[model samples]
Target chain A: MEAYEIVKLARDKKRPTAKAYTKELLTNIVELHGDRAFGDDKAVVGGIGELNGMPVTFIAVEKGGDLKERVYRSFGSPKPEGYRKALRLMKQAEKFKRPILCIVDTAGAYCGEDAEERGQGQAIAQNLYEMMDLKVPSISIIIGEGGSGGALGLSVSSKVYVLENAVYSVISPEACAGILWRDAKKADEAAESLCMTSEYMMKFHVADGVFKEDFSDFKGMCAEIKETLYNDFVQMKKEAPEEIIERRYEKFRNIGVFAEKKASSEKGDID
Target chain B: MLSLTELLKKSKNTIENGGRQFARDEKVKCPACGKEEYRNTIKENNMVCPFCEHHYKISARTRIRQVFDKDSFHELFDNIESADPLEFKGYKRRIEKARISSGEKEGVVCGTASLNKVKCAVFVMEPGFMMGSMGSALGEKVCRLFEYACENHLPVIGFTASGGARMQEGILSLMQMAKVSGAVKKHSNAGGLYICVLTNPTTGGVTASFAMLGDIIIAEPNAVVGFAGRRVIESTMKKSLPDDFQKSEFVLEHGFIDKIVDRRELSMTLGRILNLHREVI
Candidate 1:
């Protein structure tokens, strides 16, 4: 499929939002709220739940299932409070040794004045810094649009997976097109040029795996995701906390692509 | 938000027009106040408008020369250059043009330098280079700097001025946030100090990463520093923003920045800070 096709599919309202995934995948959910420092954000729903009998902390950027709810949730565009709330929940989960499961679906972080006033960049920065060494194993699944640093706030995980139709990019294609071609109408070309589709994401090593969507069998699709998370956690649970953080750090550390001499690699020689 | 093309055009104009306003022989009008001053006079005043105290953007090289001890800076990671990992349209050309215009290999210049006679690792972003966007090379250089600081037991000081992650590199540029943050986390774990001086127009992915991770975060006076751009916020909020919205003073009032220092006093402020954090014998 063309990257733009995948981008459209990723944004399709018919596709399941994080609400459905959380409800279907996890059991006995006790929804958490608030960043402790600020009011809770409706866009980001986080809580403790059971993933197939195993306790887990699940956080999802929910775009809402209806127009009213979407308006309330800012159409899944998280604010600084939203990311802070997610970080607060993740820290709580770490305290309880519960594995983290983040269901990412957002156009991007909200760009409103209030979001900036509350330090959106700082909130996301804290998450990226802390999540790198979070003691417990964590996994992030991009069920829809995994947009920029907002998506990445909860996505500095032990492993990241994206649904087949999900698209992730540094900037949305529309914005990229506007910046690159001086026209938002050129989004299709920008989308193609961005290499944002899940397939390209995997090839770029940004995504570890792709989960083919089975929306017709939503329960079955969730079951597969749950199983994958459970199995991965069970294996990850065996590793030491230090090892978990080291692996997480290394996963992101090796993400960039650059040209350098073999001997130059050891320039730091920290060890 | 200004488009990349506009930024590129502005950069080209700056280069063709003899680079920085202070680099020219003609008088330049201060953006904040209409007072005009000769380039040499403004340069002598550390690029701050003598009348309104308006801070003009300084080049990365000039920033280093102004803040660090004379002849103490030794540039590192100059060998690393940006590459088109995703083969995005016009990425290579943009980089090439940025290289020629900015005279820098990447968006940031990293190295070891002495501040107030105290050794520290430093990085200053080149605003002339794609608006100091973070791509793979920039990220790698920052990560390596933090690592070097940790190993050498030196503090790391960074002057941040970026639009955000470079879209040309796609997810690779976005990943730099996590990558650099990881390195910062490691340095923090080792109890190494990190100080960030936020400059004009620091926003987006860079602000969302190591820029805000600094142990002591300072902003230059009147610098436009925020997560989202003014236009983005204005459109999203559907309201006109206050003139001071996202400026350093506003950010300080909002409790994000520790202090706002004038450019003329920045070197002395940094010197005092370094002295305070200097390791005990």
Candidate 2:
């Protein structure tokens, strides 16, 4: 299928968005959706698939194109169940020793009163904690807007990549500008300053690389992603499982280090 | 072009002649010395008396700098700006005016710094800016800073002083409490350290989340720290307040804060603590 055709199809709510994308990108894709404690969340879409003949786990935020479908998918924002479902899938991937690839595109985690009552915060926190210990190679790609904890719930990885035009940030640029300056008009400035764009993230080491400049060619994009996945998986397989886990753990352990002047009185003494 | 003695005489004459009678009538007596001279100067010096060692109110910035290394401060998420999600009436305009007036991007500055070469991430809330309210941008920046610290295996230091969550953003502002706390937990589970320094006037949602989750919590002497204001609690409960309610010393006595240190000694104490933690790591 052509890229434009896929884009049009993605905008159509008649069929499953994840199923169509998976069929186009990988072979033998399976759908896995639901947290055992509660009902299934349609916002988060996850499953297993074979990419370039290598087994991999895929997770992405699902959005419905139409109003009815959008409401069904919680407007692409996951509730507590959605986060738990992603966590469950991530753990499954770790257990099977399969490489994990996450595609992030959501406004944020669901912020309804119901979501909060069920420990939305706890679920997201658990995902962050569990992802650090996952003993498998992982990569996260921002295909669209990566918003707040909802996007981050499935975004912890050894390498994080973003589409050229993708925006990834802790909060929406509009939300930041509105809250800080009290003017939604300052959103452009907020976006530039927040380093939400892929180019800026790559410069800051937040993102490893940018994918196809224009996601217009689905076949070509899939091929490129396949090659990248294959290379990353091979490199990850070279390191021992324990070493991989340690490296992944350390990757999250060292983010900001500021210089401090050593105390002169304590400088010379071993004490 | 008046001499110091002439200015003093003029000021004295004005006071004696009742030129500033209204100002003289509103004078606050010093509790420790009973002297009406130079009250603000004492508070500016973290409540330490120049003549005697009487501790007062400590600013959030002073507390953070004291605890970190002399030159090891590197602010993280310094460029992340905030927005008004709710677009509440007059909220945007008021924030713009405040931003220009305060000369700060936001109420809090978060970054990576060191205490005695023990690297840690620190956030200092400036009450001068919008009462150091926690909005979406402040929350995101703080959470991201924690993420950075967790990734780097460093400890975190947060100096909190806020009028509570930003009301201008409505529910979005309140959501930051959970967001920041989640980040703090992730950092802690990664074996990172978190030290919360509560300064004057830390209340509301700020206290409910990361501020209360510090592995080692510290506060300046006499700082006001609580979930709600004294008056509100008193009025709601229909009771008179204690002599030292919500004060740092009182909280310390109640075991909420780990210790109450003078502003001048805060840095040295934090340095020692960081050094000890570094040795353990």
Candidate 3:
């Protein structure tokens, strides 16, 4: 399939949002609200819940089900407060030794005057900094659009999974097109150039693996995901806290592609 | 041909206040106040306009010389350069052009330097280099610097001036934000002080990572500092923003930055900060 096709599929309004996954995957969930430092952001919905009878902290960017709900959720675009609220829940999870499960789906963070005033960069920075060393096992599954820093704020996890149809990029194809060629209509070409499809992510090792989508049988697909989550957590739980943190650090530490020039020469090994 | 650093040093030596400095023929007009003066005059004033006090966007080498003690900067990781990972169209040429224009291998230059006789690690991002975008090499150098500081028990001083992640390199550029932040966190956890000087136009992924992760975040006077671009926000809101919006002064008023230090007094301010954090023997 073409890269833009996956982009469109990932952005399909009919696709399940994070709320749907959490609803199907967890039971006995107590929804949490507010960042304690600011107002609660409905775009980011997080809570404590039982994952396969194991206590877990759950966080997800919910796009809402309908037009009214989407408007209320800001179409899954989070402000600085949304990231802060997610971090608060993540901290709570760490304090209580609950493993974390984050569901990511967002066009990107909200870019507005109010968001800038509240330090959007700082909020996302704090998440990346804290999440890297969070002591508890954490996993993020990119269900749809994993757009730029917005997606990365919640994805510095022990393991990251990308749904088959999901698309992740440093910038939206439209934005990239507009910036590169001064034309938003060239998004198809930009998507092809961006290497944003799940296949590229797996090839690049940005994500661990791709989860097959079965929207027609949502319950069955979720059951498989739940099993995978249980097994991964059970294994991750076996390691020491320090070990988990170290592994997570290494996962992101080794991501870039660059050559180190030796002292005497100008170029070293690439890859 | 002299290296850029050596050329700067040569120029600094010739242009002492009373020196003939016959090379002062080149004049530059200030972008802020539109006052034209010899380039040496602005350079002598720490790259701040002597007329309007406008902070000129300076190269990383000039920034290092202005902030660090005379001849104290021992550059590190200068050989590390970028590779076009995605082989995106025109990316190779862009990197080549940036290298030539910026006179640096990457967007940032890192090294060990002394601030008012206080030893510390320093990294200055070059705005001339694609607006100091964070590519793999840039992030690796920063991450390595922090790790080095952690091992040596030294404080880190970083001057950030970036547009954001490099789009040509694709996701690897975005990954650099997390990689550098992880390194920054490790250094912080080791109790190493990291001071960030946010310069003009620090935004996007760089802002959301190590730039904002500094314990003491300072900005130059009137530097445009924020996460999203002003144009992006204005377009989103469909309304014109205030003239001072996203300026360093505005960020200070909003309480995100610690202080807005003038370019002339920045070295002294950093020295004071470093001295206060010094280990009491």
Against the true structure, whose DockQ is highest?
A: 3
Model 3 sits at an interface RMSD, in angstroms, of 0.8
TM-score of each: 0.94, 0.55, 0.95
DockQ of each: 0.74, 0.03, 0.80
Model 2 residue B160 distance off true place after TM-score fit, in angstroms: 5.9
Task: Place model 2 in a CAPRI quality band.
Answer: incorrect
lDDT of 1 by residue, A76-113 (tens): 99989898899999999999999999999999998888
lDDT of 1 by residue, B42-156 (tens): 8888888999998888778889888898879898877777767787778888887887677676899999999877999999999989999999989999998999999998899
Pitting candidate 1 against candidate 2, the one with the higher DockQ is 1
Query: What DockQ number belongs to candidate 2?
Result: 0.03
Candidate 3 residues lying further than 4 Å off, grouped into runs, are A263-271, B1-24
The order by descending DockQ is: 3, 1, 2
Better of 1 and 2 by lDDT: 1
True-structure Cα RMSD, model 3: 3.1
**Model 3 residue pairs with clashes:** none
2 or 3: which has the higher DockQ? 3
> Each candidate's fnat, in order?
0.89, 0.00, 0.76
**For this target, which candidate reaches the highest TM-score against the unseen true structure?**
3
Q: State the C-alpha lDDT per candidate.
A: 0.89, 0.67, 0.90
**Model 1 off-target regions past 4 Å?**
A261-271, B1-25
In the range A1-271, model 2's lDDT, one tens digit per residue, is 3322332322334533444456666788888878887879999888999878888998878777778978898878888788889888888998898888887777677755345445454466557656756788888877766665666667767777777666666555566677677887776655644545665556545567887643456667767866887798889878887787667655443332111233432211111
